[model samples]
Target chain A: MAENLQDKAHELAKALRESDEFQALQALHEEVEEDDVASRMLSNFRKVQLDLQDKQMQGEQPTEEEISQAQKQFEMVQQHDVISRLMEEEQRMSTVIGDMNKIITEPLESLYGTPEDEQNQ
Target chain B: MAENLQDKAHELAKALRESDEFQALQALHEEVEEDDVASRMLSNFRKVQLDLQDKQMQGEQPTEEEISQAQKQFEMVQQHDVISRLMEEEQRMSTVIGDMNKIITEPLESLYGTPEDEQNQ
Candidate 1:
């Protein structure tokens, strides 16, 4: 029974991963919660974009100090406290939603079960 | 938005608690998991039942020592270690099941969502 339960758990996990619902939730989640890791990843991209915009506006080269400051800011944002909180919330929401599903399905089977069986010894 | 989210959480909880599935699951659970707290509560009841059954078979009254021994055994069973694990498993299973439902439902919306909108800022 324990082995069967474990197998069921794996099957369930696979079904969830391939599910359209999982994809949709993941997409929606991407919008709702931004990752510090990814945001940190794109720091260089942001710096390049900012540098380009600055050059376009001022027609002046950015100083080494300015570039250094921007890098520091990018690093700080990458590990921002808010980003950490968002990650936590993301994890919590996932657990909450999963629990809600179980609440919906498995519990109902007993209501329709026979009364004699209900009084199991 | 926080208030709305809180309200939704409450609604979800209420829906789950009152659900037919919840009732059925509760019943089924009663059969599978014997709680130590309740078992302790019914310790006296068990002693009475055993004493009555023994008297019927042996056609002899149970001695005070026999009753006391039975009570001690009942008390020990009431707080068995296995009951605690069952309680833990019950909680874990509830969370797992709820998570599965969310995986099944919310994620699908993104698969059907527009590609343009998918690239949200």
Candidate 2:
């Protein structure tokens, strides 16, 4: 039964890959990667973002200035055509993946309840 | 590029499905399904859970008794071997899916900035 479920999961993965959302996201990623300027900008943005995340995870809030600087940089990156389109595609792909996850976890929801249940109790 | 990214996502999904965690989850799901008592209990639990979730989504808090009743029912369900195993498997599978989602969204993270950025600003 486990093996069979594994097979089903694999099948679901295949279907997800074949989805238009994934295809669009992949295409946009490639387009962004090919552009040196956009690629460089994205890398820098990610570095700052990760740093901020690490700080937050450690219970440190980013300074106001740091937050402002990050937001400005983000907006600058979004100004790029390839970057903007890639972001859109990424969002679509995320939604698709989220839906898939919901389906996969439906059985579990039955057994243990949901986050709301935990919170309500 | 989109096609390639899709391929990578598919590969990640395949790896996830084949993982020990996923196999365990799949095995437990089958085990629960095969037991009539456990299966019926799960079905009822899910219906109640969904209703609760719907109400919460509408900004309604369940009454104290409702919350207590649901918790009691959940605990009863958990006492069953198949149900408990299934719950454990579900958590494991959810973790795997979460990790996969993180990986899949990493590129997007690099592009649009993190959620913390939005919150900070």
Candidate 3:
């Protein structure tokens, strides 16, 4: 189950980030089937580790006003990174869904006809 | 098949919007279970109806300048409406997914352990 995999995934992510294994895996990710469990898991873990690092860095505490200001700056950068990444993902998904919606709805339009006519007829 | 439903869906969308039925259905939609096929379908249809209306409104023929300006305004409003609505939906879905993911990953963390220790130990 994923319960066990969670730790393993984190470990794998950390190892991959620091280790040459990730570089090797990256090549495989491109050439090998993306659907391969190892490839997918590795890819997902890589993103997870990066996000976790950003989150950890963003949560740092500062003692002095200058440090606090620097911490805030760092937090903003991390926050922006996370939010922008998510927004980009959402935009991509929406675009894909929108395209699918268009394709799927095209035939529907022909079958159903325009709304104006539906009321009169 | 969806092929047939597509046409029926458009026709139904028009009817619901024009008829008093939509008002009645709107009331029903609130009381009825959201997961109900009819309610969900109606909800989805309403959205489609509104988007189509906006698109149609924006496409009206304009004279050399004024008409084009009006059309452009209409188009921006329509585009923003559609994009913003979709973005809102995406944000909502992401929030839900993020929550679920946190819940799901909690157990996984316990099972795996920290990445740093995984490689060393």
Candidate 4:
């Protein structure tokens, strides 16, 4: 509950925002959004992702056809110049967040033990 | 990607672990685990949660009766002294992580605007 811990967290966030990956991600994302063709392509890709998420939330499986459709939309978006670079940078940023999450949750993992730790027994 | 940014992230995590909320959560969690009655109650509560999660992954919703059973077990666990306190500390820790996530994703938010920001337009 220390206030400084929260402040440190925010500072790390600011540093990440200033990182090259984040800067590129923001710039490319903006460029894609501003381009009519790229925006439509990205919009289509986002629609498929949201549709799958909605179905999962409703406790329904996405159909095989639906999955294939989504894959096609993803590939189409990836063909865009700015969209492709944005996705690459997005992956890098996601990795940063994932790493942060693992580190942040280490205390909980130590208390309960990881699922991987259980499997080794 | 700055190495310092990642190093800073790990440092923030270390700070969080050293915080009072995390310390209390860990101690209480272990105390609950070592108590036979509390352990068993917690086990039952966890089992229901895992079962519901499994069902959801398989695209099946929990029935009303199943939901009621899970709720009953949750209430029962809350009746325990250490369990209740542990849950309270867990909430606090979760809030810390949630706040971190919001801050960490600010760059993305700036790029795309928040979902709330979109709704207001």
Candidate 5:
């Protein structure tokens, strides 16, 4: 029985790999990697973002200057076509993976129950 | 690029499905389904659980009687070995799936930045 279930999971994974969303994201990722300017900009943007997140987690609010700096960095990244496209593709792939996770956990959800979505009602 | 990412995702999914955790969960799910008494108990438990969740979502707390009834139902199911095993397997599977989700989303996490874990500091 375990073997069968594993087989099914493998099939599902295969299907995801064949999905267009994943393919597009992969392509964009490679493109970003190849462009030094875009790659550096993305790295810098991520660094600023992580720093802000770290501060917040420590119960420290980012200073106004820090927030402004992060915002400026984000805008700069968005201005680049390759960077923006990669970002969009990343979001799409994330959504696809998210949906898959939900499906995989459906049985557990039925058994353990989760919070209901009031807004969906 | 997108194609390549999709391929990687597919591979990851396949690996998850083939994992021992997934297999054990699948076997338990089958066992529960085949046992009439266990199956009924599980179905009833899920129904009551969903109802309680729905009430909460509607901004209504379950009555004391309803809470007691739900608790009793849970206790009854837990007494069954098959059901208990299924529940444990489900938890294990959920954890496996949760980890996969985290890994798949790592790139996005790096790009967009998520809240840092203060406990890890």
Candidate 6:
């Protein structure tokens, strides 16, 4: 039973991999990596993100200057056409996955029952 | 664009929810929740489980006695018919969702490229 479900999942992944949206995102991702300028820009943006995450984990808030710096880094990365498209595609993909999560957990939701505000959603 | 993908995801979730396997699991979950004996048994099992997780999070390894105690609690819960059925169903559902996650993450995996050994998987 588990093997069959896993097989089905692999098939689903293959189908999604072939999708235009996924393919486009993949192409853009590769493009970013191939361009030293764009890749460096992305790396810097990621560094800022990780630093903020690390600070939060340590119970420290990022200063206003740090926030502004991160914001500037994000805008700079967005200037690259391939990176811009990749970000948009990532957003679209995230939306679909997020929706799937809501559905996949429906049984749990029904069994435990959601809170009043969530139930309405 | 994002809305369309989200709508499609919702449709896919609806289809999964209507499947017989999902329905059986949901019914079993409700049955266990409604059974006083089974509910209490499962609660004890979960308490043991959380304690082990807490220990691990604190960089502590559970002693042999702790592991043995958790095993006893798990075995006790499995003796309950509804709880057993619910556990089986949860495993099945998790397998499907786990597969979906593999498919959903293909782009990220491609973009970052997994560690050399993990690439084969």
**Candidate maximizing lDDT:** 4
TM-score of chain A of each: 0.31, 0.90, 0.29, 0.84, 0.87, 0.82
Q: In model 3, which residue pairs have backbone atoms overlapping below 3 Å?
A: A7-B112, A111-B7, A112-B7
- Screening candidate 4 with a backbone cut-off below 3 angstroms (N, C-alpha, C), the clashing residue pairs are none
Cα lDDT tens digits, model 2, B6-111, are: 4544554456556687667778777877988898998888778988999887768899988887898899888988888888877767666565555445545654
Question: What are the interface RMSDs of all the models?
Answer: 10.7, 8.1, 18.2, 1.7, 7.4, 4.3
Error of 6 at B18 (Å): 9.1
In Å, residue A7's CA in model 1 sits off its true spot by 29
Cα error of candidate 5 at position A2, Å: 14
Per-residue lDDT for A1-121 in model 5, tens only?
2444545555555565566875677678788889898989998998899899999776687999999999999999889999899888777876776766665555555544556743455
Error of 3 at A113 (Å): 2.5
Model 1 segments beyond 4 Å from truth? A1-121, B29-96, B99-121
In candidate 4, what are the lDDT values of residues B1-121, reduced to their tens digit?
Answer: 4787878787887887888888888899889878999988888899899999999888787999999999999999889898889889889988877887787777778877899998998
**DockQ computed for model 6 against the true two-chain complex using alpha carbons:** 0.24
Cα lDDT of model 1 by residue, B48-89, tens digit: 776768785765777888778777765654475554444455
The candidate that wins on DockQ is 4
Better of 4 and 5 by lDDT: 4
Please rank every candidate by DockQ, starting with the best. Answer: 4, 6, 5, 2, 1, 3
- TM-score for chain B of all predictions: 0.32, 0.85, 0.29, 0.87, 0.88, 0.81
Report iRMS (Å) of candidate 2.
8.1
What are the root-mean-square deviations of the candidates from the true structure over C-alphas?
19.8, 9.3, 18.8, 2.7, 7.6, 5.8
**Candidate with the greatest TM-score versus the true structure:** 4
- Per-candidate TM-score against the hidden true structure: 0.27, 0.54, 0.19, 0.85, 0.55, 0.63
TM-score-superior candidate, 2 or 3: 2
lDDT of 1 by residue, A9-111 (tens): 3444445545444544465446434665655544554567577678756657777887777767656644755544444545555665555344444334443
> Candidate 1 falls in which docking quality class?
incorrect
**Where is model 3 more than 4 Å wrong at Cα?**
A1-79, A114-121, B1-121
